[model samples]
Target chain A: MSVRFWRVRALAMLLALFVGGCTAPPLLTAVLGPPLKPLPVAGRLRRPVYKPYHEETMTYNLVPPPKADWHAKLKALPLTAAGGTDWVKALNENLIKPKPGLDAKAEDEPVMDLDVVLTPKDAPDFKVTYPHKPHTQILSCDNCHTGIFQMQAGADPITMEKIFAGEYCGRCHGPVAFDPASACPRCHTAMPQ
Target chain B: MRQAALWLALLVLATLLPAAQVSAEQGDIVFTRSSKEEGADYPPATFPHYVHRMQFKCYVCHDAIFKMKAGADKVSMDAIDKGKFCGTCHNATIAFGPTFESCQRCHK
Candidate 1:
């Protein structure tokens, strides 16, 4: 065929292919970008073109479990996982044996102290200085009360053993939230300041 | 004769229909259960009309929390604790979940 005639035919064919959504046959190798590679699994590929089910297009901020003390802001707190890490033992240790200073008695008001009630049932009427304003200022409500504190105050029946397990103060002081050892006496003061 | 019979049936049906049929087939959400048993009468503490209107859109609790249309959301105490139905908000913020046992707050 003549050069001019051949060119016209090729142009028309290209136009038809474009309209039909048809492209040049696949080459043994890719013309532009690198050849597609197999993807990871878990990580499964439902699509033929290796479109990943969980390609993890973006990184997400991992929410390290919920803090406990922020919970007490509520009128009452519950006694479940929400119960400030539900670690009464660790909490007792921190409160009674806090870092050298930052002691519970550091606060002026007795009612505002971070001292523990120890036994809610035995000392039902024995309300102690909670030192709430200072703590709340520094931490979220769950820091002391545990996640469940929003439901009730004397809620967890908080015990030293429980606090150690990371229920009350342990929720933060233990490992994830805060290092109970950082200043054991700071929160768990041996004596009132 | 057939037409007459059909007409009679229609009239009877119309009369049988109660006036002002309740839109909420499920009725208003009530916390109390039928039994007087100590733990019986509380069903996740109903989500009142006022509360729903105040906190969120009809869209959120509708299809997601409850099926669209009125009186369709089935909020169970166990489910709320598991973070379903009312649990979506209650566990997160609105209120505590069933897992937390603050008897007076919910039961009362």
Candidate 2:
């Protein structure tokens, strides 16, 4: 045979092997029609036909079981009534307890409540009252202080658009922390005059 | 000769591209061992495998802390408290400890 003929034959063989190996049975079935049905059994077999275990129907209930109000527990403590000593001071007085291991001086030092008003010029009606005291209970100051919000006031250019896009406060507030959308009144406390 | 070299390079690239794409996209695998086990106190632990994969490689836990096969690892509260399985990471300093307060974080 000529060298050219031998080369063409070898190339054809390679292509055939590649195509055969790459073509899955399911893909071929999809392209063509459904595969031929299995031969019908005349009588019942010794063992029963396999049925996949349905986890939803079959699984045992949890022993103690999860609380129905589990998601509700994530909500922030309700705000104190409007006509009272500063909300922060009232919240601190109710919740803050002395750390057992801390020194006498450290124990005596009151829980720092740095409440700030966030009033964007665009949204004159809505003012965000950021109560730092509650967050301090769960998270260390550095968690948000330097990383998200600057220590100095008005340093970070926080906007509603940025928060919704999962920047700054949105990082934890939306997913891990409180539900930002539902808990609007929790943050936006200032009543429009 | 240059044409043959280009064809060879293209063949190699075609073979590697699919594998690279598969490894890049790792989906979340939720573990529901509580359903199988008898007398589970809480709901099944929803393990966000994708979340951990972001920080560390697959080999960090697979075949070391946990077996490659599913349902192979016999995880228990006692085992975790002794810093055996999940306790290795959930030792307070590394991650939240498997204490009473943090139960809902995973159990739900």
Candidate 3:
């Protein structure tokens, strides 16, 4: 047999020892693998090439902020019922000062929660029945919580301004999750003029 | 002398041919399943040969059960008894190496 065959077979056999008593085929050996670079003494497993980061959709379960309520929805109720606070005051107190919490989070995992909303927009008071469970099965929580909104209960103000600016719900409803180029009425329709 | 030269040329061809093959090697194994009983229906992990090679050394899985050729890899519980198949390492680090548990693990 050829000496090259012997050498390749020997090398493959040595490598196979690392896994089990299995031998590798000489044919699989690299013919002229870049120069005979020395395997790192300690970091032998280091890869010679770098791989780029790939992006994918992340999902997270969303629950209505419990401790605090959306001031827009609340304020729309009645001057007295919404604590008789102005829009700015409500934003500063409810949405801005106290942030929202995620309640829970994990790598590649979705947060789940049953939603209960009391909105006074064009509809009556009722729970949103947000698909928290179903959504959790598909999304990552990081996909939702942003620097604009704290990872808590009442951080994201859920404002028409920020939402249209592609902030809170706008992040996905338009760009991240859906197309945002359409007419503005899709999201702003419910807002009081 | 002519015969000796011919053998030498053949030897060179064998060595040179592998180099040629290596240059042509765009080593990435693509896995696609069209069978209604595969992937979604079957979760056997289609076993990406190239992908596995990307992150691992040949020794990680050359095991006695697998050979160079595709069908040549004799993967069976019977061979596993002799420390073949996944049982080779499954015994040391992967799990009980290849026991009653392993037979059912892979076959099932």
lDDT of each: 0.39, 0.52, 0.36
- For A1-193, candidate 2 gives per-residue lDDT tens digits of 3566777656755664555445434354555456553333233232222222334663222232243442232123343343212223423555323232213343222345889888877885588888876666434554566767898766799876787777777855553445466566778886532
With candidate 2 superimposed using the best TM-score fit, by how many Å does residue A115's alpha carbon deviate from the native? 0.7
Residue A157 of model 2 has an lDDT of 92
Which candidate ranks first by TM-score, i.e. highest? 2
C-alpha lDDT (0 to 100) for residue A62 of candidate 1: 28
Model 2: lDDT of residue A74: 14
Best-to-worst order by DockQ is 2, 3, 1
**C-alpha TM-scores of all predictions:** 0.23, 0.35, 0.22
lDDT of 3 at A168: 58
Compared with the true structure, the alpha-carbon lDDT of candidate 3 equals 0.36
Q: Which ten residues in a row have the lowest lDDT in candidate 2 chain A?
A: A44-53
User: Which regions of candidate 2 deviate over 4 angstroms?
Assistant: A1-110, A191-193, B1-108
Strongest candidate by DockQ: 2
Q: Rank all candidate structures by their TM-score, best first, as comma-separated numbers.
A: 2, 1, 3
- Give per-residue CA lDDT, model 3, range B67-105, as digits (tens): 323344645434545566555654423333343212223
Candidate 1 wrong stretches, greater than 4 Å: A1-193, B1-28, B31-38, B41-44, B68-71, B92-95, B99-106
**Predicted structure with the largest lDDT when compared to the true one:** 2
* Model 1 C-alpha lDDT per residue in residues B31-65, reported as the tens digit of each score: 44443445442333433432232223233343445
List, for all models, the DockQ compared with the true complex: 0.01, 0.05, 0.01
Model 1, DockQ value? 0.01
Candidate 3 lDDT over A79-153, as tens digits, reads 322122232333324432221221223222434765434243555332122334433333334434344346654
